[model samples]
Target: MAATGVSANRLELLQIADAVAREKNIEKEIVIEAIEEAIQKGAKSRYGAHHDIRAKIDPKTGELALTRHVTVVEDDWRPEDELEEFNDSALVRLKDASKRDPEAFVGKEYIEELPPFEFGRVQTQMARQVVMGKVREAERERQYEEFKDRVGEIVNGTVKRVEYGNVIVDLGRGEGIMRRDQSIPREIFNIGDRIRTYIYDVRPEAKGPQVMLSRAHPGFMAKLFAQEVPEVYDGVIEIRAAARDAGSRAKMAVLSNDSSIDPVGACVGMRGSRVQAVVAELQGEKIDIIQWNNDEPTFIVNALAPAEVSKVVLDEEADRVEVVVPDEQLSLAIGRRGQNVRLASQLTGWQIDIITESQDSERRQKEFAERTQLFQDALDVDEVIAQLLVTEGFATVEDLAYVEAYEISDIEGFDEETAEELQARARDFLDRQAAEQDAKRKELGVEDGVLEVPGVTLPMAVALGEGGVKTVEDLADLATDEVRGGFEVRNGERVRVPGVLESFNLSQEDAEMLILQARVAAGWIDASELPQPEPEEAYEEGFEGEDYMAEAEQLFEGSSDAGAEAADDASDASGEEADDASAEDR
Candidate 1:
């Protein structure tokens, strides 16, 4: 540890190791090892770099030893390191060594102890840098191990400094960063000021471990409630979900396992004392504590409190909900800048659209008229007959084409002959539509093999042809995002691009299935590789959670025929729109 020549007593060496280990909060053995490595570097600089010089220090006695080892090796021995060609000082050929000692063979080592020497200025500086680097590395590792597992826990710290509006806090044992975006809006922190934050993430970076702290995280609010509410902390009441427009408004859903206890009332606390404490810490943010329910409709209704909802229509496949509210409550339901509805969407895990009753009525009527017109034109039926079919729940010509004769005949005023005539017309119309789609698909260069793939219809084949996917291999090489549609960033704004199958409203599973089947038909993968249904118990235990569509796309893209290369060059830039929420900024 000293720049002077080894003038210090042996006891001083042990003391230096113990002091450094204590100061850095590392193991004494690590500090001793660091010193040993520093000595090795210094020795290498003094002796030839090609010489195999090693240094070792005694832990109990602090006795240091330096030695040089020259090993006898095969005449053609070559270093495994590509950067190294040969070293004559550290290695000697067996034939050459045998001239001095007949017993000398490959792997035989001759060790020589070196006398103590004075430390030069350059070697001293190099040793100091090496020692400091190792110690600093150990300190960073210790800090990471201490904090990585503490994620999701609330911690209190004092602001150490601010960089670019981000607050760096001194957390007693480690440093944490509260990113500018992760802090509550308008909340300022001065150096030395105390702050409470949630440990959302801890990453070991190249420079050091970064503890990502957040004051505006939903988990922060949830943790605050646990500290204030005894029932929540004790597990009697569970905070099922939480969403926040940090420092402005928030919503939390609570569920009570006990029938006798009210989750909302308990969270509200006696005379709002518990809730008030949390709000004070959050800079006066308003919180809506709603009762959580198992039924999704009931849950959505509860999530949009203070607004009277007339009806809720849930689209399970799309994870969207259409909520109809009274005209007067529309403003209240949407809140200022759509905050209320956004929080509700986040809380319920659904995309919510709040519309007034009048709007819903108008949309229903428009849809009904469109369906009626479609039946009239496709079946060549009169308005009266089309209206009857629409009222009977027949929305498309395909519906009449596929329905059993008895079902259509059972409709009031529709006998077997009428049903038969309607079905005959529906079938004839579909046949002509299929033929037209097939002609277009062929003209677009889509192969007949594409239509033969499982789950692919003629209309889908035509859509694929338009999107630049022609052959079975081309279809198999499509990512689920490309087929299901996804959003793309353009000119700094997100824009939705429709996928080839976007109009078909295919679910994620269905889109993946289409690509998987196509891959099988294209000979890229075996049909036996397709996933099969498993029992619920077994599925839960081993849900490989594999993405067959993505795997197939990766396996075949850029590795297929010239047709696939052309398809890739001509692929559509559009994709499905991704789901999003406004309160996501929080």
Candidate 2:
């Protein structure tokens, strides 16, 4: 008879499959399918040649059954097949002898049944190994799917072990890997210790799901806040931005949709209880909660908490900001390694260059001193001349050099010879200043520093004197042509200023550079150059016009519709054209 306990073994195997599924958190059907495939492979290898074989186990009863394979033989081979079948196995026999083929060839194949011994001890062991492997693989796939989308979410787990500074967390379903880099420095964990972390990432590999956990990400704090704050969870309070130096400190900008609720106060809780809890969870890491702002300067001031910003100078062209703070708050605003300001820059998406009030004043003073020294050096004068000019209100190079020597003599206690000396000294100083200014302007792609020859007509000189446009530096900084109301041309050609060469003569490059700068500075002009008029006495020019027309007649006749339209258009187009034109210049 067959092995009487085969049914018992099958029932035990089914129970083992169910237990494995439960232990691995996999579906029982997966284990069942694995076992079925394993058994089919083993049976095919053991009995495929002689007969078709099938193995199956009942899901409900767990009963194992086996079947044999067969094919009908021709009538001519009937007696031979019956004899061969009887010889093939003691359990095999031809049920219909008259249907067998007597002349069946040697190569012809037939069918027969073998006992359960077909999958004997060796084959059964191989099948069991395959099934176990497949079951483990299925379990890993299930675990990966469960956790992949869970990144950035908070998860709680017990610490199973620590190896080389990494914690192995038992996350109920599987062990998640928490790398040393992911853990806050100085944090400690012991076996069976319950800890909270973020599911930072999940990656699938040949072995299993690699679930990465993080305790130090800035978002970890935000996620925890959401869990703790009902308003955040319900979307009433929104976290506008967050920056962190991981375990040491963090800053969060928050805003509220509900004006009735103060976001900062709400997040802090009464008596600092709520924020204190978050800090406690972070193991004493400091947190600063600030009000979010759309204005960069206001936002930056908030980001540099505890330090008051007196002013912000935004260089929008460079996407940079210079923040001025009180003298006492310098160290606070800069922090260690400029960490405070750096975080503020990162938080606000602007490059911040910070200076204290005293520091800025000192820097400007130093720059002015250097300019004065250069002036004295070029003029071969003593410091007294610089001091005298500075005392007499001729502080800027443009003021002293470009205004004319007569103006210097006009000051009390000044002789013509003294005035001439001062004018020469001032001109020398302008040349030096222009050289330095041009270097800076060239560096900024604003202009090429070139000095203008001292021979241009008084009108052209006055036009150039409107802020000392003799050098590329001056031109590069010109107001946009639209703002100036028209472009200035010299001799029917756009005036080009030389860039970054000491030659006093205006080259084509210099003229082009000048026209570009004039366009920028004057805030007016077209693709073509319009002749710039010589400077005349402002009062005399207007007085001559007044001589010809009465006020009412001027209002009616002189105020042309075209002129009004042009003025309005220029006003509306001023800054916009400058921005676009500057971009094109770049």
Candidate 3:
């Protein structure tokens, strides 16, 4: 066929397609498809907008074909609405269509050949726009596909621009953004500067594919260490956990698979070469490389290095630990602005409370006295017997009543007969205590519906009743933090105020379950309709230069008082009625 007036040579079309595909980093087929669509659009404008125009290009020969499709239908079957959708030039009746082609039938489509028209300036511009838009879309798809799996990997880029603390990076293939908060604190970048960052996320957006880079993320530090240390790269040393205060300090726990290789020494390298390389890249951030241990206490002790730990008490139910350090090492263990203990907690996945040896001793003595008094009052035992029970680690009447007779008998100065008598008294006292609490619960007018909620113990109900949360609706109206344990401002410092369930010594999981049940009972939602709470992101530790010596002194002085205050808060939450019964029983 002869070339049309506006048609390019077949070789030119093939060359343009190849050049555009390479420039856009997209498949050649995608570019050719876009070219075909643009030609089809131009053809429709030339022939008639209402006519169905299609175009195709041969991959091998670059031959172009343009055709106008005419649908054949019965004259009577053409509804007015359907006829309005087409022009007379686009549709043909079966009988009339068969005149042009001897065997045309209803439901058949006939292709009509037409000479290509010359392209006008407006049509050429429109075709250019269509090709550019399609190419852009294809480029974006290619960018997303290329970088999606690259998330969590480190990439090197040159700074393209810095806009309001956010750095735009030219990542060789595509552009990436390092948001202001994602960059290490106080770290600066200038245009054309070489920077390395972790590709934390890749999102396809309307404008283009968004690549998110981060330097402050803990994973970024881990990746840097893996890059610097050969043992880490080879899996001989594993990075168990890492916590950072970006641009200030970081803590990483490393475990060695081979017994001969020391994890911490390997990470540090010979003469501190490996860790120093990572530290320099992070803008002089101090890093602590510690050996990881399977035993939690040993791991925690290692995490809080440069300080001697006198004692470590684990509260498994609460997932908290109490670390008692020597008086001289208090400042070191707590670090500047509590950074050491906080990072240790994050690395170990536990809440840590650090106190000095003196504070721990004082707290222990006060606890001993309180337990002795509690046992004496609840079990109607003498001071001598109470002391013996306390010394045996029986802190409550429930503990005494639940233990085997032989276990209690093993206490110094206690025989099997005395143990049996103590057990009986303990059970009787508990029964009387429960009866009294039930009476108080009724007197406070706690709703029966609130009582029916699962996980709501009698003590929790009594506390809720006293707090004016009388019905399931009232309970459901409480916020999650309020139901769990809200915060309070004390001496201008905000601290958590133990909630109703916490006052009863219930676990957080139990409290959440109670709240969920209350929500269901209040007709607020079905059990299946509850939304899962999103996991909280780990916050980077912040460092401030504080007077650690003075702060440690203050913490030591208030350690026992804080324990007493918490106990008093718990007592008040359970109601004044229970306190009077205990006083009378004693």
* Winner by lDDT: 1
Clashes of 3: 0
lDDT of 1 by residue, 304-374 (tens): 99898999999998899999999999999999999999999999999999899999989989988999999
Candidate ranking (TM-score, best to worst): 1, 3, 2
Each model's Cα RMSD: 11.9, 16.4, 14.3
Off by over 4 Å in 1: 81-85, 101-105, 378-382, 401-484, 487-497, 511-586
* lDDT agreement with native, every candidate: 0.88, 0.70, 0.83
Clashes of each: 4, 36, 0
Give the runs in model 3 whose Cα sits over 4 Å from its true position: 1-5, 72-102, 105-107, 315-318, 378-382, 401-428, 442-502, 507-586
TM-score of each: 0.81, 0.57, 0.74
Which of the two candidates, 1 or 3, achieves a greater lDDT against the reference? 1
Itemize residue pairs with steric clashes in candidate 3.
none
Ranking by lDDT: 1, 3, 2
lDDT of 2 by residue, 319-407 (tens): 88999999888999998878888778877878998888998889877866776775576667678766666656666666776777777
Model 1 score (lDDT): 0.88
lDDT of the structure predicted as candidate 3: 0.83
TM-score of 2: 0.57
